[model samples]
Target: MLGYPIPANETQRLAALHQIKLLDTPDDPVFDRVTRLATRLLNVPIATVTLIDADRQWIKSRVGTDTRETTRKVAFCSHTIAEGAPLVVEDARQDPRFSANPFVDCENGIRFYAGIPIFSSEGYALGSLCVVDTQPRHLHEDELAALKDLTDILNDEIRLREHLTREQQRRAISQRELDALHRSLEEQIERRTRELNLVIESAYDAYISADENHRVLDWNRAAAAMFGWSRQEALGQSLQALIFPHGVPEYDDATPIEVNACRRDGRETPAEVRMKSLRVEGKHRYSLFLHDITERRQLEQLRDREAREDALTQLPNRRALDERLLDAMARARRLQQPLAVLFLDLDGFKAVNDDHGHAVGDELLRDIAKRLRHSVRETDYVARWAGDEFVIVLEGMAPEAIQGLSEKLILTIEAPIQLGEMSLYVSTSIGVASYTPASNETAQELLKRADVAMYEAKQAGKAQVKIAQQGKA
Candidate 1:
């Protein structure tokens, strides 16, 4: 069997591929969903997200096949990626490229294939999302378009996963480099003192050497610039007074540790500190390396917030809502207080989308999210449960107050949303389900009850509030 021709930029492409480190790992549901969707949409028996490795095609996700991998010579995905575009074969038996291939010549072999190249952010083709069928078939124009759309989604997930993986690798590398530097510096200080001084002067991070009593013995340029003091001013000063005026962390550990560091102006900054002990000319000293980590901390916070927020509405997503529900239930049980969950579903949202467009509908949903947010108190939690649906968790609310709050939310949503010249209107049906200490219901049950009540509100004409009558037994 003839193998697909290797790409001209195969070396660089493989380098980018290996850097993502996705090969032969555990199954990821994020990629699994893409393959599953591809099978259902394309009506294929086999669908896979495959990365073309040096010798094999590794399946990141697969549906309708037990084979996790196949040789690159027999992989249609290999050819698809090699072409750097979509490859569609109506009947593999009739296609010269794969007619003689064992995958097609064997009994009940693959007869149809459609694959789209998945590229890295650097424009290198890394792999492909391909669907396979046992029976010969041709794809309609819409089917091709849908397959492409699914591939786009797969590419997005790949990019996000790659980015997060690279960030983690970078942090690990920084720690390893610091550890190596610490060991090398200790050896250099023991054998050659003058060379150690030159190394500290050219170092990237702030370096300070202090005596056993915490008096600064040596201050590098980085240290002077970081703490707003010249080398002359920092030398002989108390290291604690210069950077740890408020408090000091245990600097006995040789490994890196995170700590709050004070600047000359008394401003605080988070830093990664690594300490090394040295004996110079029979004098005891400690060398400290400080690296500012404010940017890293901020990036971590942003990533955490993004994971818990809905991109469309900037509200707490379903994951966050579930956590909030569990916490609220726990507090209610401890305090012996009452809590309520209000499930809201927007009415006439579909009509608005169909009448105007998705853009208008999106703007309207954002407006509704804002109105719903402002309609409730800051103590209450609002989450976007799904499209056109929201869940609000309220703690320590009386029955009368819960009812009033639900009514207020409905009224607020009923108001016209002005999107430039056009005014859009939508109402919400609220379902109220309260939990008491005696009830002792799970979060899922509470949400189900509220959801059921919401349907009742819809049944009793939209824009009405319906309270769940039965509590958990």
Candidate 2:
């Protein structure tokens, strides 16, 4: 047997062959039908459509054979492909090319061989469609022409198969690209949706959205908690019936209204509500947002009280006392009446604080405040001016009345305060100043005179009262 040299571009040729992606695939009836027809028309015992690869000759279709592949070097179709034409050995025993071939001497003896090269469109001889016989025979011109015609038919089939294979591959690649694009679009939509949800949740003002017929469509956490309703309970319910069964009467055709809404805990909370009508899915709906104003109203009331009362002792402080003193001065000037101011200071209160504790001294001061408040008329103002010092404003009072009230307050605060398991004694020095506003006396001048007189009383003795001279006023 003569050895045939492998082609120089054999590796590239095989690579190109495999690039068509047609190896080791399941059998197809179209190629099988063509091979069957070839065997019957040519009157051959064996026929095959063999595709030659790098290491093996694989049969794409075969008739009258169980084997699908054989070694490439020994395969007759391999030589036919290399020859690049039809190869015919009328008698294998007589032909030098195959005289010593194993097929000639084997039990399944081969005496005739004919093969037509299957050329690809690119002119690469891929394989062959071949017929073999065990009996020596010679082919007539008609028989040879018929075999060539069948080989042409085989070539057309291979071309059609290659076209279909390429088309199927293109379809698969296109489907993959479409799937990837769809996945990308879905991911973008999901990312945008999450960002929108985050913005809605973090908003400071509560926001809610609902479908038509007042059924809840969406509720944020702030909205849920603000109305004291859980998300689960609030969804898909009539907003008016759930929150405000009795509609706010203040909401006329033009004006939006505020109302008290009942919370989950049965507390009535003040809220300002605004509503608007909308259409969804061809039906009417309403959206409502409520703002709770309970804390704001309470703060306003507290501010009013703080404006007129002292923070420390809960009494009328200097600002309040000053206003009343000016009022008394106005009335005194108009009616030719007298007004008086009494200044009192707790004596040895600091010494008591240092000996005992500031807590006990604070209790003592509070007790003195109660006594001082009780000693004055309802019209008079008693206020803590500073630490351990108090001032009293007396309206429409003469000199004798001023002296009498000052003494009473002095005696009241000078009494001992009884603490638990302890007794604390404290004294006060009182000073009185009388003013007839018609005598060109101002409120400040009267206050200064009372301050000076209080110091004089302290010098005279503790627990005593002194009156300012008329010349000072």
Q: Judging by lDDT against the true structure, name the best candidate.
A: 1
Q: Report clashes for each candidate as comma-separated counts.
A: 0, 0
How does candidate 2 score on lDDT? 0.77
TM-scores, all candidates, are: 0.57, 0.48
lDDT of 1 by residue, 26-70 (tens): 999889998999999887889999999998989999899988989
Residue pairs in clash, model 1: none
lDDT of 2 by residue, 1-473 (tens): 42654655677667657756656878878768767877787788888888888878898888878888877766887788787878888888888767777768788778888888876666677887788888887876776677778778767776776787778878889989889888998898898889878976765545566665556777677777777777788888665656666643333434556788766676777776666667777876555566778887799888877986777677887787778788888987888776788899999899889999888888888888888888878887888887888998887766766767777776777676889878788889988888866577777888888888899999997788988877333
- Single out the weakest 10-residue window by summed lDDT for candidate 1: 246-255
For residue 365, what is the lDDT in candidate 2? 80
- Model 1, backbone clash pairs (residues 3+ apart or across chains), number: 0
Which ranges in model 1 have alpha carbons more than 4 Å from their true place? 1-196, 252-254, 281-283
